[model samples]
Target: MELQKTMQRSLRSEIQKRLKENGYTLSKLSELSGIGTGHLSEMLNSSPSRAITVNQLDAMATAFGHAPGWLYELYPEECLSEGKISRPRLVPYLVRCAEIGRKDCIKAVVSNLLENPKNISILFSVAEQLFQSGKQKESVFFYELVIDNEKDSYSDQFVMSQYRLFRAVQGTNTEENWKAVIRFDSYWKRLPENVQLDALLQLANVCFMMYRWKDVEKYADELRNLATIVYENELLRRTSPKANDLLKTERHLVVYYGQGFLLKAAALKKQRLYEEAKQYIQGYADLGWFEILDETGQQEVEKFRVWAKINSYTLDMMLGNYEILPECITFLEDHPGEIFPALVTIMECANKYGFCIDEVLERFSEYTSYTEDDLNGLSASRHFRFRYQKAIYELQRERFNIGINETLRSLALADKMNHYQDFKQCVSLFEEHRHHASNSQIIAYNKIIEGGTQTNESSVTLVSSSFGIL
Candidate 1:
């Protein structure tokens, strides 16, 4: 087959590259591998196909300082996709390929490994190990293998794989999160207590990005209740003082509680329930979670703490406590680009209650690379919201010239992107500020909003995306 010939050529190329890297020649490889000079040359260099066997591959692998199955992974799918290869012989090669970022080889070997349903456990183990190693792309590959294999089953591994896969892909801006969201909502009550806790936390986090504040609050409460149960169970299981290591052992629960507090605060903040949101924030700080966390956890809690405070800053606007808003943004500016979730949260709050945010916008411009076009997927919508709020703040500051310009920019953006509500919102802003604008500019803005004028959509396609009304 043509595929087999291509595989052969790839192997020969790899052998030559490795030989040069290893300072080996044809004679040296033959001497070290105990393969004849003619056969080795043919296998590694010949154009036409010569059969490559496991024994021959093993010999080359031994000589090349690789695992016995390394060479086997270089072959194309035509040679490996069928169940001809034993699972035992294929798993190590596939795992090595996965670890080394050899995605094509992984694809080839998966079919061979997946020929038997019993191999699912081994596959899941590899996926979990890869995930723990922070090789999420490869982990998702193997986790999906398990998902594809399990089909309709609801076994423990299946559920865990589903959870892990969802968590892994949450921020990738794929449509998969919506499916995962639906699944978690339907199955939360039936899940294990710990899984319920994880699912709820994950739902809250994902729904926050989706701008689903009410759902976020609901999931956060469920997450809090589950964390409480786990904490109680941990206490009951241990009597001695050493058992009091709950703080160290149950670190995720600590994060869960912190996250729950912030989400609950945000929801209440959105509803203008500043007093209740403040109560939750004060309750969270009173528990001293800030002291017990590791460096990463400490930083995360502090960021969320600031994030909630920023929301409260807006909620407390009527009470004249909004002055701290600038200080909170300054704190964020000082930290640089460490917690992106905090950035998203800040932008969301700014868009909803943004006032006098010129300083914050300048800070974001100087301190962040988020404005680059490369940020067009997961964080693209957030970036647009950031710009949107900056415009609102301009209007708030009574910078009529800049506000009109921003309104024009926003209107042009909304129309190009087919943002119906945003175009209307921009029109409303223009009407409010029409008294301050020149008649010509106002007419131009109205025409754009009415779809009576042509504007370049590509101009704003990469400018930003995704905003909702305050």
Candidate 2:
């Protein structure tokens, strides 16, 4: 009954009547709501009345023994003044609406606001505020709305919305991640420099995961050049003959500088440019001398130092320098996090150079097992790579049963991870060695193929075309 009354009346009228019915004076209501008496009177009785904020409305709701957002359906009135959206009132109200799961109210308010196309900026601002406040999932509604309504593709807000959306949707699925990259690719150069730095870094990382080595090198080089220019400019800015306002980036400046080199080196290694990759590795190997080392920056420098060490050894191992094998194993034993990737490299080297690593494989049999929790961060991709490489290694050694089993296991993970490229490679590898497969291995292969067929049938575009099908 009370909800119906609230539905029928404006928020101000509803609050006014509630105070009267409860026998609460202006002073009493103000005391209950923590609103100033003068402001309360202006809100309830003035000729043109002041707009109420969402917080004040929520306070009044609490004062009147009602739930939070009890008056939300009527609260949209406070977000307008003579039919112009009251930004000061609307912004918080929209954010609060999202917080309280008032999607209908959000939709009503947003639909009215968007009648004027210029209000896309207003929506974008609200989205940015929400994103900054750690309301990422909620911000997607506004970002998507901005993307849908935005007319200028190159506009900062549009590009920013695209970038934010891109970041939000990234996940373990490689095909979906690639689609996101493709959607956001053109907007990379158009983003504000701070956003561009993070975007380029993300682009390079995603490309690395997809085995897009050239693209990784391209974006990583761009990230390096941009970070250097920005870092140098920041230095000049700080030493200027005026105020000392610092430049802002999503991460510490050194991270971009270091990772730019790190990712580029990683890509170079993937592409078999070992010596060239080593030079880039040397680029970020020592960042203790970088300017402006805060605690976080210092920590990043330490990380890069560690990465430089691991990757330097990684390069030597990749070059088939078998002398350092035991040393690398000890290093990996010391840093368990590096084990899966190191194993991938080890298996690859073993396959390429025709070396026996049966003992080495047994040494880390725990990680060699495909448990999700065991390989937490680099879980899906690295495991997939390791299994693929192990399959190749075993097959080259004529160990058909173990090789085909590894191939089937990798195919299952690739399908689940939506890693289409690896999935195809696994399929091709399995077919090439099908004649040696035992009956049960053949049955397991058939089941995996059937599951993949169902997945491809259900979401053909996502499963196939997004990764270019071939």
Candidate 3:
């Protein structure tokens, strides 16, 4: 196969031409670019010129009154050393190209680098370096390259790249989030144990939001078991003292352990298994007794303690224990972040047991009016659920105007989120009470449905445009 050709003029040649044209000596260029004259001389004039670093190249460009990547088209020549890909030159160049939005250069360099299959590892490392430096969006280009070119599915680079791609691809769009989760599901177990714990927890959370209760339970169980194993290994490590090579997780060990129980219980609660969920909730309730509680671990324990109380009250409410209602409200008032989900529970129960929450609804009226920013925050899923439940609660109370409006808002949000279950519920609830809706409400509902259709079409166009990039 023919190696993809690079620019005819070398990076050194371009720099030399630029210097002569501007009548700037090497010493003057070095002073302006913050590079030493001796080093710049070696880079520009050696028999086999020393490779120019990305920072130095950018510096030269700036000193020459050009943009950061002005000489990038000529850089592919620098990435080669006697017809072979040179890692030292290629890696930093590709990263800088991504930083400067030079996809044309990235495509050209990556195509050439892939001709020899062994060069795949260099791309994987480039992806990792970019990711670790918080250039997540830019790193996706190399990660996708790794995924497409990697032939060994079980290789560590292949698995790690898949995991990174999964994490990097998630955004506010629920449909996209779901697709990412599904694509990443099978690979979670193949990741290093530390990452696997975090991945499982994330999977459960996403599934929970999408109302995929069974999948949530599945991931939660895996999380619980793995967290236990990791915790025990940590215990043995503490005792053994063999240089203290700890398995570093993204969060505290206690967090993964607690969340394992917390998620399992939450999923069960969603499935209406109140009694079964209570057992799992108790598992995380008193993690204060857990060994090796660092400050963060202690804080996670307190969080679980709070979650235990919240979930206990939620189960009682679901079981029609309305007598505990006042205390539950008091507890929620103390934890503002928990208020939205608590409200969702309150509304769901009211609709279930034929109770009136007119007072409860009035008390938390401020939270009902969600803003656009809420869609990107921690409570996005809860906010969506709250809208749906509030619509049901209002419709049941015979408040036609408010109910229809809330229904329309929930329907639009669900469609935007690609939350099919909630979307269907909104449609069914509206239809069931269609007789009560005004002419304007009916028209509004029709438009929301029409808008959803258009959004899906636009999404298709976007995915088509994005195909080769991934």
Candidate 4:
């Protein structure tokens, strides 16, 4: 009887506490849960509370988001002293089960927690576990629950931020990624303007990734404005060297200006405005920004130069301006070790006008050499361009067999190249010859041509053939 009385009192106290947290008076809770107000008042007022039915306890628990079992087990000491059975403890055990990737265990745990709703921390912990295991969508739902229930909590915002950032890192769609930016932006805006600048910068980075230059420009402009405001403030300017330095970093200005120019150039190029694109590129070049690049940035600038020159050559060739050929060749010769872009330009020039094949072949042979290791140290695309030029030159000189031999040599060289596209082309060419010659014979001949063997049998046959060796 004492055990029963203690359990009743504990249940009444637990119910009242939950009702208070939910902003409900006993009268209001009774109305909400469809329990009689008189019975609730009596339960709360009794020295040892009257026994409530299981169904009544469940109704009150549902209304107030409290676990009925948690309330029932609160008087465990009393139950043990009186030799009465107590309800079980399961929340911690279920949490452990979820940790080991047991889906059934996780489902059972989630179901049990949902029955009580007050175990919000357990729900959040489960969501975090799911998220860490790559269950993004499920994690998102539970995170939403935590946010809705705990709006004033800083930890809730942080968790949502982490989830959104993870999705962004995993390369979510542009719209969704931008939505996250907007969400973070809105939150940051509520802070001081100075505090908001970093968030704006992050949004700009996302815009840059999505190639939304206009949005990048917009956010960059805002950051610049904020920086200026901070800069003009005597107090902030005097005390905040870090902020001042951030404002002055070249990345802030360069990304804003350089990306704007690039986007404009791309738009002009797409519209066949070759002259306009050249004007913009030349404008950027004249600013000396390209010259100011550090080692890695300088390499990037060189790559851009090659890309720009190739496009320019294509345009000039389309216009039948043969004079452009000399300029293109000069550019290629100037960049000796950087053979890919140079070879591309030479081939384009050769294809445009019927240039002297033997002369080009002689020039290419004089200009290039293979190392003992056969590692040309050139990019795969460039190396393949060199091989293609060589093969075409030999073919044009009526040296089909030598061209075939050189093609086979190129296949061997291609094996050591990095670029898959170039490797695929070489493999395809090699495969074409397999139908006419034994694979082993071809491999052996290729080895000789690659300087792996001293045998001149193939060279002798080429010299004797009607297709004369060059």
Candidate 5:
């Protein structure tokens, strides 16, 4: 009889909790369950006064996973003892809250569970939720707590490494923050080489964000060497029936190799080794390994190609290779809507070599008229550059007011799109042009000053396309 009453209280509490989690008010739930709202209210408020019908209780139980008899046992067990019986049910509710972006709710439930020594899985769930919400610091804290509590769990190492990696990344913009990443890499390297490779890639990204070009190059070289060694070892082994399955599992190795090559190219670009950058980027493009991934990878590879071309054009301009500028322009013309990097390259060439901005603007205008809609679908960075160039063209043609308005509008769009660097550039350009006498003069000056002032802003948060690789 005592057990029966305990079960009733547990069921009632669990039902109420589920309904709240689902955002259903008592009245709403009553309507959905086809029960009188007053009766539902009375039952919930009664505190085990009257026994609920098995059929009605079963309906609620079926939806929330509580037994009918459990709803009747309330008074004697003042507290619902949460043990193995409740932990499983609580996990799904916590997960549901997280899925709906309810971070505070997740925190509340997770905190409650954490206090009860048996709820270890709650820590992992909370860590995952925090990470997804971009709350890396909190994620790491919870993950560390879990690791300290469950030292023998096999997943502890991987979870700890992940937490450390995110912690290091969250502070990457500052030199002091990079130390955490370095520590993470060190810990990861102490693991097996395969595990080390994953950490190495993340470390490379940290180096890139911190603008530690030499470290980026160093890591890329190490990764390449490691990949080559692994490939050779695999080649020397005799094939078994399971070899095909193992080989299939290793397909990610190609992605790792491709990323290493891509990073090496970016490092070269940063060092002003334009030709080297182009060669490496082109090699990755030719390998077509990027195609093995999703659409995001393909877009990223294309963006890298644009970066290579832009740097190549800059190098050519520096070397007085006037012939290359037109070729670059022609290549951009052939690839109509990929205008941002191409525009940057064109501006670099024109600003350095004294190419007529008016002519370039005219060409761009003509190009946009032909492919505006198509180009709109390019990455956000590309879209901003395209609009910026169009605004420049309008300004040059004596459309000062219209040009300012259009440029400001583009800056807002870029901001919404989170193209931080591009948005900053657009803002700077607008501020410069806003003071000009007529819209026509602004347009002329806009062309001449295409590469006007190099703002040291970092790139935007990784777009979905670029994020897949990370």
Candidate 6:
């Protein structure tokens, strides 16, 4: 980045030194070099960056007994006297400096080149290198330069610029991400088969983040189609000497289709299409969905597989397949994302069956303890459910006042979140547990329920669950 002007010889000084050494007058030198005397004088008198045109440079270097490209090659960086830098020489240094983790060098190059609008290609290349090295945020400025200034729509750089822009915004769950996908999908369909498949998998993620379930299925089907073609061609390439090429890998298909399966399974479950949902899980298991994640995707495939399995168990539970409960508990314990529904289900089933309610409560506590920190996507219903687990824990342990207080807390949170499902569940827990609850607990619960649950907590009442079900 630091170039010493004092130690470096100026092109004007070099030309004068060569002229004196050769004992050639300006007119004689210009005549021999075939450059006009006026232009030759300007070349020697002007600064290095603007010394001469390429043809005149070649002519002068050759007449001075140096190689044709020798003069320009001698001075590659900025010419401070002329305030002009060489694009060809400066561009590579910027890229290499970034590669070796030299931020100061890149800053220096960018400061000089950013003044010239045409250095956008260098900007884009350096951006791509930064992106590959996991510096996506840092690479954003370079992508913006090409995207904002370059007008060519059909070029690869334009397509990549849009794709990278989509990558940058998709995780924030912003409206800009939706717009990015629209821009990305417009040209994504026309890309090469391999390139299109890569974008297709990412598009599925974008749709998933937006909760566009049907679009997830559509992209999944598209990915399956593209992957099948790649696999079929891979079969063709097997006859060649380079049969073991990494390009033949179709594991991405499994990743995309696995996600698609999960999304479809979830949608079908919502529609009460249990048989169809079960079918999706069967397909997923048939492929050994866990192993298919080896090629990797943006989402954690193993975690996703656990989620899908938990979902399958839910569908089983809804279908009266109570036998799947223990396995479901194991998976819910294993992977804790999307935990609200599972917590509610496990707690209700545990209470109904008189299972190890304390162990279940502990599991609930382990998973739901994260709410105090306000994690991303921590919904109000989930928070309500966490408090519900706390209430049930207290009730099961005979701490009636604390249990009732927890239910009241859940009621307050549910009301604030407008979570009717949690409100109803809280009411039901009150109905089933008021026998052991105290006067203040009963009054508080009744006030929160506000006629949704009317109970006489003054008398001895027995509320029994089937302890033999387990």
Global lDDT of each candidate:
0.61, 0.80, 0.79, 0.50, 0.55, 0.60
Prediction-by-prediction clash tally: 0, 0, 0, 1, 12, 0
TM-score of each: 0.63, 0.77, 0.85, 0.34, 0.55, 0.53
- Per-residue alpha-carbon lDDT of model 4 for 1-470, expressed as tens digits? 99997656755566676777789987888887798988887767776655465456557867876544444334233222243322233333333343434445445444545544455665566556666565544455556556555545455444444443434232213334556666565455454454454455556555544446567556656765664454356345547655443333323332333434443454454355657766655533432343234565555455455545555664565456766766766775766544443455455456547565354446656555554333322222244566765665655566666656656656555444323344466556555554544566577656744656332211110000000000
Q: Which pairs of residues collide in model 3?
A: none
Cα shift from native, residue 287, model 1 (Å): 1.9
Candidate 6 structure quality by residue, lDDT tens digits, 43-119: 67654324455455557888988864444534334322266555454544444444445566565556666676666
TM-score quality measure for candidate 4: 0.34
Residue pairs in steric clash, candidate 2? Answer: none
Give candidate 6 regions above 4 Å deviation. Answer: 1-118, 242-244, 248-253, 270-272, 288-308, 320-323, 331-359, 371-470
Clash count, candidate 3: 0
lDDT of 5: 0.55
lDDT of 2 by residue, 346-395 (tens): 77878777888899999888877765434321356677888889899889
Question: Candidate 2 local accuracy as lDDT?
Answer: 0.80
Off by over 4 Å in 1: 1-89, 96-108, 172-176, 187-196, 240-251, 289-311, 318-365, 368-382, 395-470
What is the clash tally of candidate 4? 1
lDDT of 5 by residue, 224-304 (tens): 677666555555542554453223322265555656776787677667776777676655554444324446546555655
* Per-residue C-alpha lDDT of model 1 across residues 136-195, encoded as one tens digit per residue: 666777888887798655777787787777766554242445666876566456557756
Candidate 3 C-alpha lDDT tens digits along 83-140: 7777887888888888879999888877778998899998998899888887877788
lDDT of 5 at 412: 48
- Which residue segments of model 2 deviate by more than 4 Å? 1-71, 99-102, 134-137, 152-154, 243-245, 354-379, 391-409, 429-470
Runs of candidate 4 with Cα error greater than 4 angstroms are: 1-284, 289-311, 318-320, 331-340, 357-361, 364-378, 409-441, 444-470
* Candidate number that wins on TM-score, 2 or 6: 2
- lDDT for predicted candidate 3 compared with the true structure: 0.79
**Best model number under lDDT:** 2
Q: Candidate 2 has what TM-score?
A: 0.77
Better of 5 and 6 by lDDT: 6
